[model samples]
Target: MIDIKNVNKFYGQGDSSFHVLHDINLSISEGEFVSIMGQSGSGKSTLINIIGFLDDEFKGEYFYYNHPIHEYTRTQFSKLRNQNVGFVFQNFKLINTLTVADNVGLPLLYAGEKRKAIKEQVKDVLEAVGLPDASEKKPTNLSGGQQQRVSIARAIVTNPQFLIADEPTGALDSKTSREIMTLFKELNQKNKTTIIMVTHDEKVALQSERIIQILDGRILSDKKVNA
Candidate 1:
């Protein structure tokens, strides 16, 4: 569903510039669960941003579902992302002030969905994430795991075709992380959601069907995992 080639990303200009990603090439198929593993500053997050259409300052080619993503305008990217992508960050990016349902429905609201439809979608996603009773609660009132579940619920509420998770388990305990991974597995297996996750944890990466390791801004390895 995604293809990239010779991608290079840099910060700053001319002499003061620092390269963040270099000559990256990859292709991910539909219904595949892939993990990007790298140390801090190894360009894992940068790659994710590029894939999710969040970064457009780099030099390279990107094609999503045969659409040339590299040439999309800001508005085009926004529309495409809203329609096809969902994101989960290491830090639960939920608004502390919004109720769980509101947080989960933000994307649909921004897309101009009607109130009744948004509410139904939010309710379904909450139940899917095992958070049926969390709709009226603020994020601050939830535990770490519950908060992350809310984040996941928000990401999947739109039924996006692709899910991008960057260190999604970074903030939770091992048990909680395992629970989150189980949820991810169910999403991939049952929902056929294409998942591309960036994680430094090998154990977390192993849960994916494929692992891509990055080092010094380059892809070090890409291999399928044995079940």
Candidate 2:
């Protein structure tokens, strides 16, 4: 569902320009689970940003389901991002002030969904993420793993075409990380949810169906993980 060709990214200008990505050519099919692995400053984040439609200041041809995302207008780009991609971050980016239901419903709210529908969708996602009773509780009261679950709940509430998970298990302990990975696998296999995750941990990356390793500003290797 995603195709990127000859993509390049740079920062600054002229003599001081810093290249962050180099001729990145990649394609991810619908419902595939892929992981990106790289060290700090290796440009993995930049590549995913381009894939997720969060960055457009690069030279590339990005085709999403045959649509030229690289050529979209800013408004169209924003709309595409809102409607197709869901994001889960290492920090769980939840609002401590809002109830779990409120947090999970933010995307739908922004999409102008009605209150009744948003509530039902939120409930369904929370249940899917194993947080069925967490709707009324504040995020601050939850454990780190639980908070991450809430974040996952929020991300999937929209039934987005795919998920962009950036270091989703970075903040958790080994056991918690395993649990989260299990949840991600279930989502991928059962719901047929596509996942593109960026993680430094080899164990984490190995859990996905395919792993792409980046070195410096280029792809070093792309291989399928052994089952």
Name the candidate that leads on TM-score: 1
* TM-score list, all predictions: 0.98, 0.97
Candidate 2 segments exceeding 4 Å error = none
lDDT tens per residue, model 1, 1-227: 89998999999999999999999999999999999998999998999999998887889899898888898889988887788899999999999989999999998987879878788789989999999999999999999999999999988988898999999999999999999999999999999999999999999999999999999899999999999
TM-score for predicted model 2 compared with the true structure: 0.97
lDDT of candidate 2 over 175-227, digit per residue (tens): 99999999999999999999999999999999999999999989999999999
In candidate 1, which residue pairs get closer than 3 Å at backbone N, Cα or C atoms, i.e. clash?
A: none
lDDT of each: 0.93, 0.94
Pairs of colliding residues, candidate 2: none
Candidate 1 TM-score to native: 0.98
The per-residue C-alpha lDDT of model 2 at residue 175 equals 100
